[model samples]
Target chain A: MAALSPPYLLFLGDSDNPLSIKIARGLAHWRPELCIGETGGELSLGLKKMTPAQGARAGAKTFIVGLANGGGYFEPSWVGPIIAAIEAGMDIASGMHQKLSDHKEIRQAAQKHNVSLHDIRHTAAAPPLGTGVPRSGKRLLTVGTDCSVGKMYTALAIEKAMKQERLDVDFRATGQTGIFIAGGGIPVDAVIADFIAGAVEQLSPPADPGHWDVIEGQGSLFNPAFAGVSLGLLHGAQADILVMCHEAGRTQVKDMPGFPVPTLKDCIDTNLHLARLTNPAVKLGAIALNCRVLGAERADKHCAALSEQFAVPCFDPLLHGAGALAESLAGKEE
Target chain B: MAALSPPYLLFLGDSDNPLSIKIARGLAHWRPELCIGETGGELSLGLKKMTPAQGARAGAKTFIVGLANGGGYFEPSWVGPIIAAIEAGMDIASGMHQKLSDHKEIRQAAQKHNVSLHDIRHTAAAPPLGTGVPRSGKRLLTVGTDCSVGKMYTALAIEKAMKQERLDVDFRATGQTGIFIAGGGIPVDAVIADFIAGAVEQLSPPADPGHWDVIEGQGSLFNPAFAGVSLGLLHGAQADILVMCHEAGRTQVKDMPGFPVPTLKDCIDTNLHLARLTNPAVKLGAIALNCRVLGAERADKHCAALSEQFAVPCFDPLLHGAGALAESLAGKEE
Candidate 1:
């Protein structure tokens, strides 16, 4: 439960998956001090590889985090470098669907080194089913235009800004990495199909009326490959307010060819409609744009333009703090 | 794989669940010939039950089918009557979330008696994830007003009607009861959340152009309790045509109070919208009314009125056939 130490070794396994790349990029941009070096095998996908030796040279009290997103890449064969990382007296953290702790060799190595294995997807207790009763709380859910479009990052940013303003708010994580960062939360996608909503319900139980649950979203309604999870999260969140998250200038849904990218309007409308099925009074609170791909000038111009056009507060929370969003949420309900 | 030779001895095991009542009702109404007797221990719900002796005197070839829902109902202590039933040479069938074969005593009893154990929710192959690519063939998914509203029955009826008409059709089940009846199909609810859609996608793969996949639906979008699974099945089915299933005169979502019953129009519209997210051209082909509560004449009149109201074919497949709905699907496109 202790905070993961700094000088972390990020194991990309081959640096092949888009998810791995995203996580690497996110760490490089956000918490570079925690990151020492990256490791990848020969068949890595996105960028070139770096050796395990290079990855571990910085310091010894480091942690190894597997960062693959594709299927079948987390097998036993990939455990050698992970074992080496463990034997080097570094603890392990993994967001991979395949938990590193489940592998015999990895667990043995971690035990020998007396370091812990953190499996983020592992739930502490079985969550109860959703009761469908209306709970009293202000919940803000992040809905995205596509998968891996910064729903988690936006939520984290918003929570950071809210805390800075001394607000009573909590970030409810639903995915693996978010779970890891948050220390404890449901891995919503790993639950049985019927209980996804129930798990979410239990996570953000009723509290004070002013208490805000900033829920992490998954997938997207526009992403054909993962819309089910998206809809599940949307309905389950039962949000009083929603934040539309999008990567600016994306032309298509990820991995799904010929499927057109959803515009901001479309994303907002779809999210509102779906969320309203459960929470009829749900409203779009703001737009947290992921302008990571855009230039500073262009991002600011588009954010301002979108704010004017939609008549809603629009900002990249990482660039422009979520203080404006929090302020707008207080005053803007028209 | 042979058809279960059944003079069924229904084991209710202190039947305290509504799902137990449903499975009993379904068998009593649809497969009366197969059902010989019903047994419930002390804590049974609903109507009174007959003894196991009364159940088996009619015939020797009998199958003891455990009819219960929820957890921990299939414990070792509850295995006595099941063991007796197995000793009496009845092959066991269970639709409980718990598999009877997994119990030590039950497995030993079955082995000693040399009787087969049929776990309806047992999936044979590791089904592949959905490709999200355009696949060939026609698929018709049942979207429902709520859970246990006869979505599975309607799908079975439609497939029956289609097959009777000498059409190339397949009925793909998505829940325990449907899987029991169909002999083989994915148990969508039993599947892990991430793989629910993929299991469905594998169940109804691309077939001949004119071949029809009549996919049984689960849960309902309006039902907050189980909507996650419902939406997953909807997106996964990738149906070109959809049939709306509803129980007549139901005024609210089952088990979840304060949630109003969705109107036929609302159900159709919601289904079409959600289905369109995956299958853009998806159409609500017909309505399969579950008018089990109504008198024959009343059922007929309501069916006729609802058909007129929705401008779509509507019928209780048990009262009339799925013929009209099938016929309407073939002719009506507007």
Candidate 2:
């Protein structure tokens, strides 16, 4: 066999997209020649390059269709076609040459797939994030939706946990919080964008050379329509992992019989299992248990169970015992 | 000063008519040498034997008073008695005996001073607390009140912070919660008691010979009244140092400008000040900042300030960032 070609997978996650990066990094370790591809024009180029490489070797493509990190506005699942087209045999991967055939394929696939993915995000997929929207121009932004527990809390908990371990990190400085407030509560999309601005500004940030700088998207990725759009941006930006959030429990421990508190042992086996069961080999970086339903004890038990059960790390957004989820990935543990 | 005599002060919080052990331990701390005399017939004998020992020493008598931490169920203004007793050269302490008094002079003086002090208990102001029960068989089980941020998100934040630093603490073990239902949730009194039970259990676990324990109380002397019993037990336990919890902001720093993002350097001064403010001669143990209010920025700022301002060690409960709130105190790092 000739020199093995690099395996590229497209990943898209909403705001607070910690899980995506986790999966990306984890996969990087699983195989030596794997590069996570961002969803956008560059991805088109990468996919085009994959063929010649595949002509020389073999190329494989994968992407998370619909991810729900926060709200439902971001669940269009049509990103599959672009990735599939590029994978199948597209010569336009040289750059952003939108062939009429690609548009027809995206439109027809969007209709068949329910959510119109490509038609939505006409704006730059990696929109000068981290930099505030151009001081004067009012441009349409792709923001994540907010439900009960969303991006801010997740970001805060993840960062705080890292700081606990004596790692150096700055959320606004490098990790922008682009919270989209159109849907009421502080929007994580807008917050992330804002953080991106700060990151680009540098502000003499103490970033590590080893860790991958993670940009997370918050809100629902599973909504039938927005999933494709969500995947598009994630793939384009070259995100490393995704942090999925789901509602859980109620008041305290709903049941105790034989359920001696959820522990880290069950985290990955349960959460990661659920995510993958929905779509296997999608490259789930890590698992995050949103256990607001269960009391602290039960949540702890769940996280413990996940950690023990699966090789992948499992975390509870509420308990937040695992410090610095993103910081570790970003590598700048100052 | 023949051998310096017996440097002890027997403290009777309220009355001795009906003895309560909580009050007894309290009195013991105030007057270490006073042979705790029973108000029953045994008192005559007990006091007689104690008198010889007392005579051997100087004129140190049992300091009788009550309601040092907080007021009685009816009138909670007992701080006045404590302030007065301490001012009158009677070492003030925790614990309150029954209110019923036989001495008119004592009653009138106490009433005039609005002091809830008494030397007699309802039953027998004797050694055995149950010696003078009112036939209900229920000895006035002197329950100390506890009322820190009872049942609130803030409390949860405090708990979260403590655990992050690996503190051997159980935030919800007290059966306390901030969630509310019908009649304005569980009574604050019950919440306080439950919380105290958990705190005590965690703080004074099976004492190991190798570990020195650090027990956390409600607030401070200046901000007392978390519960009636803590002071007495603390006194009986001979708590040599007190770690006060003070909010970290403003007062600690002069003309501190707001930062684009919070930092650790801003808030450490306050944490240090509170810890070092322990009685001049008595050693000041570590201080734990309830960093729930202060986010990453504020918490970081305060922690730095605390380290620089006072050589005194400080902790952020939210950060659990320092050592731990519970385990560190219990000396159970291992």
Largest TM-score belongs to which candidate? Answer: 1
Q: Provide fnat values for all models in the order shown.
A: 0.58, 0.00
- Relative to the true structure, candidate 2 reaches a TM of 0.21
Query: In candidate 1, what are the lDDT values of residues A230-298, reduced to their tens digit?
Result: 777777789998988888988888877877778888778878876887799999888888888999899
Candidate 1 lDDT over residue span B1-334, tens digit each? 2345666766666655556556555655555666666676654433335654445455535555646655634755457777777777777777665777778888998899788887766665555555567678889999888877878888888987887776788888787667656555788876777777778888888898888999999988877767777877887888998989889989988888888888878878888887776789898778888888899999989988988887878889778889986765555332
Best-matching candidate per DockQ:
1
lDDT score at residue A203, model 2, on the 0-100 scale: 21
Q: What residue pairs clash in candidate 1, if any at all?
A: A14-A44, A16-A45
Candidate 2 deviant stretches above 4 angstroms: A1-149, A172-208, A211-214, A249-285, A324-334, B1-334
Q: TM-score of each candidate?
A: 0.82, 0.21
Residue lDDT tens for model 2, B1-334: 0011123333333333433334334333323345444222121222323331332243433233332233332133334433434344433222233342333544555566453432221211111110100111000001111123221222333334445555543321111111110101111122211122222322233433432333333321111112112221222122233343444542321121221111233222222222221111234344445566678787877766775565555665445443433344435345
> Of all true interface contacts, what fraction is found in model 1?
0.58
User: RMSD in angstroms, all models?
Assistant: 5.3, 28.6
